[model samples]
Target: MPGKPPLLFDEAFLRKLERLSLVARRARSGYFRGERRSTRRGQSVEFADYRNYVRGDDLRALDWNIYARLERPFIKLFEEEVDQTVHILFDASASMDWPPHPAEHHKWNYARRLAAALGYIALANHDRLTVAALSGDAFTPWGPERRRRSIHRLLAFLSDLPAAGQTRLVPALTRYAGQTKRPGLLFLLSDLLTPEDLRPGLSTLQYRGHEIALLHLLSPDEVTPSLAGDLQLQDVETAARQDITINATVKTLYRQKFDAWQGEIEGFCRQRGIHYTLLTTDRPFETLVLHFLRQRGFVR
Candidate 1:
């Protein structure tokens, strides 16, 4: 009987971030001529490097004096400048709908809110934004615009995404891994209920020069299930079932596995210099925007 709750941030929330720009640990391509230096540089008054001139090269870029004296053709090569794209990959899987009995909020609803909030942040900064739903190896592109006005489009995209299918994170990510030639930022929001190996897919993105960030979302009940007796642990997405008894040792083992899994994910992100954060849907959107994400350099 429950439906998607209204998105958290309104006009007021967006107004507070109108003057800000997207921030990253390392510089990335972007618009508006900001202070953060991008990896892709051009003839923007910042000197990059020099290379030997080749056929069809710009004659003006040639070091005339070097060619005249040393009889060598050389040209200056600045970083290739381009706008940064913010790719939001939301896992639209059935498992995201699973919640404890009588829960007020669903995992998918929480994930949508966070995605919308992040979309607003990126839109306010004039960064190119795209929202995609991962169903197996398919990427359903949502918002592919580059203006503040596209925020509404993004919201609509997230609002209507059906909570269907199983999550195949590695396959979904692998599909677009080498496709995007432009280096940008990838924001993956999910409960991570996938059997797919995320490392290989993530590594592919890194190889293409993308700065990846993971936003792991979960519900309070998922962290602490209420089953105090024998229970059937069903895979929400895959419909696979596991029967088990709930006892002190079982609960302890479950919690340990959860902690270890999260720690391993954190360590993986750290090793690859990817920004990572874990959030329960119960938290406020503003808290994530103003605190957790800010600490990770999302908006500055």
Candidate 2:
């Protein structure tokens, strides 16, 4: 890991991301006050709507202009700017760590940077953030923190994390959902190359009230393989081995299946209102956070 680049965004980059924030699709009601606007009435400067004043209501929120005109007290309900929780679930399974090739360092490394950028944005804007690495059954969680001061902790946790073992996506997600006390925006970053179907996991998160975003990552080599004939392939997770011959026909067929699988994942997420994006390890991480994610309305 000596030649590996640093794990964090630079100060200038951090400053830029500080101005951006994750978008809350709906008015979220959270326990603490934050930068995100909510449907519930609160003491924020932006006003939302008004309703008839009831007993025990605060006198400060009562609109004197409406009362003088109609003789009925109307309470002003301003849009409440409250904290929105952002959970980044990163996949640290063995398959994510491809080796013996240049792309071996790419997938998990890119994911870490992506998580760091978003986590910085969340913290800078005072949104609660929890980053959990999905290694197996019970994963490791770093935080449910909101302050920018915790950025160091986030970076450290992500940097030192190791990728290993087989991760059944469905089970990992189910466990994560069960432990999540509050849900806002959940980003699941993974290759999703596991044997388990991703549908059940996605559905579980959706049912638990988490706004899901799937960031599907694949190495460039994995996408467009240039391997020759007589290859011994081994599964990174299961250690299953198979000997096969790679011909022109094999490459063509593999490409077709790969494209189809990507399409299928996209369609599944779309039907369920989950945000999905396919990214290659070679793509600039900055482009993903600054352009691709913005285009999807993930960050603004």
Candidate 3:
């Protein structure tokens, strides 16, 4: 019999993740009670403010001390604690399976590990998390589950996902925004190789009240190509071919265009108040999570 597959995350790494939790810069409304503090005022131990007592108000909420001093009834209000809905959108398109050799650092593998780590953090903090893999026209999803017990299911779901088909970001995102009723935090992990204008999809999510964070993943090979001589490059997803000579001028132009493309995406994100981070698969997983993500304010 074959040996069992290795776990996506070791116990030591999971324990480290337990120390962190997803951060939402602004308050969000959730259906279930949890650790996150919300803007909505409700019954909780932490005091919010006091308001003049109105008819039919709960007598138990009346501030006896204020009543004695002012001879007027006042109701004590408390800050509401609620769960956050965290959505992780993973891109499993063909381009993400690049650099066929060295499977460990493949874009697909790196992205899956990152998703698993983030989902675990949310689970540890009792936040509702939904993970979806987007490819072609399909959106495969798992969980709106919370708590550490759900980590196993999350890992299994992520491990089984395969990268294939073209990435159709707009339709997939638009459909998700329409289907998901509650608005919260949304993290999109993708290489963003699609030619479609992403503004429509991103704007839709924002309109639905989601706090969006775009993790633009790329491989080191893609970022800095070392190819020389004549080359026939084919699009991984579309299979279109292009023949070009790999000369000094060509390489210089390629680098300039690549940088411009990245700048365009960054500018768009900044204008829309969306958090954007560019990541290369060559980076260590621990550094990406423990250091980079923390610096980005995604976790604390």
Alpha-carbon local distance difference test for all models: 0.68, 0.75, 0.76
| Residue 74 in candidate 2, Cα distance off native in Å | 30
Q: Per-residue lDDT of 106-145 in model 1, one digit per residue for the tens?
A: 7777677667776766665445677888886777887566
Q: Where does candidate 2 stray beyond 4 Å?
A: 1-80, 99-105
List candidate 1 stretches off by more than 4 Å.
6-82, 100-105
Over 51-133, each residue of candidate 3 has an lDDT whose tens digit, in order, gives 55656666987999999999989776453432568899989898888776435567887888889878876665456789999
Top candidate on lDDT is 3
Q: After superposition, how far is residue 280 of candidate 3 from its true place, in Å?
A: 0.8
Q: Which residue pairs overlap in candidate 2's backbone? A: none
User: Which one wins by lDDT: 1 or 2?
Assistant: 2
**TM-score on alpha carbons, each prediction:** 0.74, 0.77, 0.78
Model 2 Cα lDDT, one tens digit per residue, 1-300: 223445345576566555444232111223122224544543337554555565666698799999999999977755343256889998989777664443424777778888887787667555779999997767789989977689888887877887788777888899999988997888899999976789999999999988887999888879999788899999877878999999999999999999999999999999999988888877766666777655754543
Greater-lDDT candidate between 1 and 3: 3
Candidate 3 lDDT trough over 10 residues, lowest sum: 24-33
Which of the two candidates, 1 or 2, achieves a greater TM-score against the reference? 2
